[model samples]
Target: MIDPVIERPRLTRYARGGGCACKIPPGELEQLVAQVSNRVGPAVDPVAPLLVGLDGGGDDAAVVELDEQRALVTTADFFSPVVDDPYDWGRIAAANALSDVYAMGGRPLTAVNLLGWPRESLPMELAAEVLAGGASVAHSAGCHVAGGHSVDDAEPKYGMSVVGLVDPHRMLRADAAKPGLPLTLTKPLGIGVLNTMHKATGVVFAEAVDTMATLNRDASAAAVATGVRAATDVTGFGLLGHLHKLARASEVTAVIDRSAVPFLDDARAAAEDGHVSGGSRRNLEWVTPHVDFGGTGELDRLLLADAQTSGGLLVVGELPGYPIIGETTGFSGHSIIIR
Candidate 1:
C-alpha cells in the first residue's frame, strides 16, 4: 500500500490578509455591512473616558483624560510572514504599528511585542531575528520595548503594541477631511500586487518590497513637517478603499486623478496580466458603487484597489508644494478626471 503519510496534504498557517491591509471585496462587503447595520445618527458611546477608540476614527487604540492635560494614544498591529527573511518581516510589522501613532499626529514612546510561531516547524533563532528587526525600528522611533505576548502556532507572526502621546488639539482623525482637501499619497502603491506575485511565484519588484519593508519614520516626519490635517496609512484595503472609509465617515466623496498617482511601473503590467491578490480584487468590488472612473484604463482602476502591506501615508489637506491629485467633496459617490 502507498504511504498515506507521504500523501498527506501540506498545511499552511497563514492568511491572505497580511497586517492592516485585509482585502474585503467591495461589492459583497457592502451587502454584509448593510445586513448587520448600525443606527444611523450621531455617535453616542457609553464609554466616556475613551476619547478616541473606534468612534473617533483614530488609528490604533487611543485614550484620553488618563491625565488631565495629556491624552494617551496606543495601537497594536501584527501579521504572518510576508517574506522569508525573519528580520525584514519583523521590521515591517513594527513599522506598521508605529504608523498608527504618526497618523494620529503622535510620537511613539513605548511598545510591547506580539509574537506567534510554529514551535516545531520554525526555529526560535529565526523568531529572535524577527524581533530584532522590529526592535530596530521601534528604537529609531524613540520607543522602548516594555513587554509582549507570544504563542506557538503553525506559522510565524510578529508585531508590536505601540504607546504614544498626542496633543488633544492636534490629533488627526481619518474622518476629518474637508471638501476641497487635497489627497496626496506618500509611498507608491502596488505592494499588494508585487507581494501577491511573490507568494504565487516568488517574484517581486525590489523597490516595492523595500518600500513595504521600510518604516514610515521619514515619510511621517516629512508629512508632519508639511502640516497635514487628516491622514491614514494604506494597508489591506488598498488606497481607494481606505479613502472611501474617510469619505463615508466624513459624509463626503473622493475624486482621484488616475494619471497623477504614483505607482511602481511593472506593477500595472502584473495587475493587467491578472496577477492581483485576492484582497486587491475584493477592494475593487467594495468601492464599485461609490467609485466612479472617467474612462480610466482597466489596469488603472485595478490599481486603485491593489492591497498593500505597511504602505505609505495617504494625506489629505492643503500642504504647499504637495500637488492636488484628488479631492473630497460633500457628495455621495466617487468621481475622477479622464484626462
Candidate 2:
C-alpha cells in the first residue's frame, strides 16, 4: 500500500536556503546596489520612461511607460522548495512571482518558467508535476505560461518571470506613501516560522500552504479601486524589513500598533519554541536600529520580522477587510514606531 517514490528523501532536504528567505540580506544588497545604481549607460530614444527604478527603495516590480495610458510591469522571483509537496511548491512559487505584478496594480499578461534541477536525482515525472502546478495557478490568473528555460543544478528550484500591464497614472509605487496615510497589511505574518517548523518536522500545515498559494489579486483590486497610490507586497523582506524601506524611501515614520498585527495560527507559539529562521533573525537585526519597540517583546519582534514567501500587499490606505496595523508620520530618527 506504500509507494516507494514517496519514500525518497524529502524535497526540503535538498534545499540550501528555502523560499524568499534565500535572498541576500537587505542591508548588504542595498550597499552593493548603491555602488553601481548610478552608472551611466549608452542611451537611445526611449519608448517609455522608467517609472519605478531600483534606486527608489522597495518597489515590487519595475514599470516602464508603454504608451500614454499603459505601462509594463516586470519582475522575476524564484527559490528552492519551502514545502515537501512538489506540486504545492510549484503553485506557491508561481503565486509568489505573480504577487510582484499585482503589487504594482497590474494585470498579469504572461509568464515564462524558470527551473533548476538535478536530473540524475529527481525524476522527470516529478518535474512535470511541478510545472503542472505552476501552470494551474497562472491559468487561474488568466495569464499565459508560454515558455521557459531550465538548467541542471544540485538543488531543484522553480518560479516564473511575469509581465503585466498597468495604468501609468494609477500604478502603485513604494515611494508614494505619504505622512498622513494609514498602513493596512492584507495578510497575516509568521509564515517563515511555520515553514521552518514544517521543514524541520515534516508536519503539513494546510493553512500556511493555502495562504502562500493564494494570489493577492483581490487585495490589489481593492487597493486600486480605493484610489491608493502606494503599495508593496510583503515577500522575502518581512513586514518590518519592507516597512522600514518604504518609510525611509518616503522619508516618513511608520507607527505600528503592536497588538493590531495579525499572525497565522500558532505562529507565535512556533517562534516561542525557537522555530525562527536565520533570515528572520537577520531582518530583525537590520530593522532593530530603525524601530522603536516600545513594549513589544522578542517573540513579537521575531514575528514582525518573519520572512514571508507569497505574502500580501501592505497598502498605504485602509481597505474593507484588511486590518490597519499602522500609520505614517513626518521624519523621525526611527523609521518604525511600535506602540
Candidate 3:
C-alpha cells in the first residue's frame, strides 16, 4: 500500500524551473540587493559588538558578536519542484536550507518555513505535506520549525529560515583555505543537468530521486568531523563559480584533477543531448573567464559547473591521499585550473 501520509505530485507536466532554476538570476539579483531602498542603521561595534557575522566567510548569515562566547547563525533557502513527489520536495528543500548552518559548524535550534503555493490550483493539503516534510528534516537536525509565512503564487515553492548556535571560534567560513590544502567534494555532480533532462523526458531514476532528496547532512557532518575550514554548497553558481568565490576570498588558486571529480550516471548522455538548463549554461559562461580546463571533455566541464538547487557541499581542506586531486596555491593567475 502506498504511504497515505505523502501524496504523489502530478508529474505529467514537468516544470521549466526545477531546483535552483527557480532562483532569481544573478544580474537581476545583484540589482535587487543594490536597490534595498531603506538606509540601514549603523553596524554594531567592530572591536567588540559580538563580531560574529563580520568575518563573512560564506556563513549562513552574518553572525553579530553577541559576546565573547556564543554567536547566532541564520540561513534561508527555498526552491520549486525538483521531484514529482511532494514529500521528497519538502525534504530536499529542508536539507538545502539547513546546510548553511552546518557549513558554518553550527547546530540548528529552530527554523521557520518560507512557503509559496498556488492553493487554489492544487490541493490545499499538498502544502501541508510540504510543511510536514520540512518538519521531518528539522526534527532530524535536532531543531523545530516553529512558524513561517506563506503567499499565494502560481508556482509551488518551499524551504526554511534556520537559526543555529555556534562557538565563535568554530564558525567555519569559506575564506580560510590556504595554499596546498586539498579540495574535495562530498557529493557527486550533475544534479542540475540530470534534473533538467528529467523534466525534458520524464526520465528520473529511482536512484536519482534517492540521491537528490538525500540530505547534505552526511557531507556537512564530514566537514565538521574533518575540521575542514572552508566550504560552500554547490548551488546555482555551479562548482567553478563557488570555487571562484572561495579562491577570491582566500586569495588562493584551486587546481582540480578533473578526472578525480565525481559525476552522476544520468548526466553523461543528457548534457550531450543539450537537455541542459539555462542556469547551467549561464553558470558555465559566468565562470569561464576564471576557469581553465585542460582538455577535459566539454560534457565533463558542463557537469562540473552545472547549477544545482539543493546541491552538495564542496570542501577545501587538508589533503586526504585517497581523494587528492589538486590543491590551493598562491594565485596562479587563474581562479581554477582542471588538469
Candidate 4:
C-alpha cells in the first residue's frame, strides 16, 4: 500500500508537452518512418496475408490474424498530463490509448500500465491516484489491468499498452473509405486549444475534461454495427491531418463543411485568444498545401487542425449521435477541400 502522508505536487508542472500534442510532427514522422519501414522490408507471414501494414494502409492498431474468424490487435500510447487533476489526467490517457484498439473494431482483453515518475520529487501516493484512475477506466471496458513496468524519469507520464480481440471480417480500416460516403466525427474538436489554455493559466474546463476522459467503446461498437469499414481516431494529427490521411489511403478526396463542424464550448474562444499550441499550428502547416481553404480563415483552420487527445473516431459512414461533417469525393489534386 502507498503511504498517505506524502505531499501531492502539481502534476502538469513536470510535463514537457501536454497530452497528444507532444507527438512527433506528422511530416517528419512520415519521412523517418519511411526509412525505417524500408530498411526492415516487408514482413513475411506464412499463416495469413497481412490485412494492414505500416505502408500507410493500417488504421489505429496493428492486427495479426490468429484464425479465420479471430485476430489480435495491439497498440500502445502514453503522454504527459493534459490536465491538473491527477485522476482525470490518468483517465484521459488510458482512454486515449485504448481508442486505437476500438478504432480497429476490437474489444480490449488486457492492458499493462506504462508509467514514468519523478520518484524523488513527487510522492508515490499521487502515482497511486493516477494508477487507480487508469484501472477504473480499464475495468469499465471489461479489460484486465495488471502490474506493469515503471521507470525513474524527470517528468511524470502515464498510459497503457493494450491487447484486444477482433473479427478479421469486421475490422475497421483506414484504407477502406469509398467515394460518396459521408464522414462523421464522434466527438467535438478544439481539445488542443482548451488544453493549451489549461496549461498556461491553470484554469479548468470541466467539459473538456469530461470529453477527454470518456472512452470510445460505444462509438467503435456503433461503427462496426453499422457496417462501416473505414475509420480513424482524431488525436495528435488533428481532424484535417487525419482526414488527409484517410483520403490519401482510400484514394479519395474529402470535402468538409467548416460551418457544420462542432466544437467544445469556448473552444473557438480559446483559439481566438491565441491559446493554440505549437503542435496544432504545425498540423495546419502540414496540411495547408493539400487543403483548399476556400473562405476559411486562420481561426477556423486552427480549430479544424487542432491537435486532440482522446478526441474522437472519424468514420466513413454516419452513425447515431454523431454529426456528418463531410463526404468523400473522387480523387482530386487537393486531398481536403474546406469550405
Evaluate all candidate structures by whole-model CA lDDT and list the values in order: 0.71, 0.90, 0.73, 0.89
Question: Ranking by lDDT, best first?
Answer: 2, 4, 3, 1
Q: What is the clash count for each candidate, in the order shown?
A: 8, 0, 6, 0
Worst 10 residues of 2 by lDDT: 1-10
Q: Candidate 1 on 1-339: residue-level lDDT in tens? A: 112455421111244445444434555655665554454543477333666755533343565645555678888888776655567778888888888887777788899999988788666887888899899888977899889999997666788888888766666677767777778787888877776665555453678657876766665566666666677778877887778777776767777777777887678777767778767777777767667766776677778878888887778775444445677766754533223
TM-score of each: 0.83, 0.96, 0.88, 0.95
Model 4 Cα lDDT, one tens digit per residue, 233-339? 99998999999998988889999998889899999888989999899999999999999999998888989999999999999999988999989999988989987
Best by TM-score: 2
Q: What count of clashes does model 2 give? A: 0
Residue pairs that clash (backbone atoms under 3 angstroms), model 3: 50-65, 50-66, 51-65, 52-65, 53-63, 57-174
Can you tell me which runs of candidate 2 are displaced by over 4 Å? 1-8, 38-44
Which ranges of candidate 3 are over 4 A from the true structure? 1-15, 31-59, 318-325
Residues forming the 10-long window of minimal summed lDDT in candidate 4? 1-10
Per-residue lDDT of 102-173 in model 3, one digit per residue for the tens?
A: 777777889999998877777777788888877998898788889999999777878899988777775667
Instruction: Please provide, for model 2 over 32-141, each residue's C-alpha lDDT reduced to its tens digit, 9 standing for 90 to 100.
Output: 77767667652377667888777665478988888889999999998999988889999999999999999999999999999999899888887888899999999999
Q: Pairs clashing in candidate 1?
A: 21-235, 21-236, 22-236, 25-282, 26-285, 26-286, 27-285, 27-286
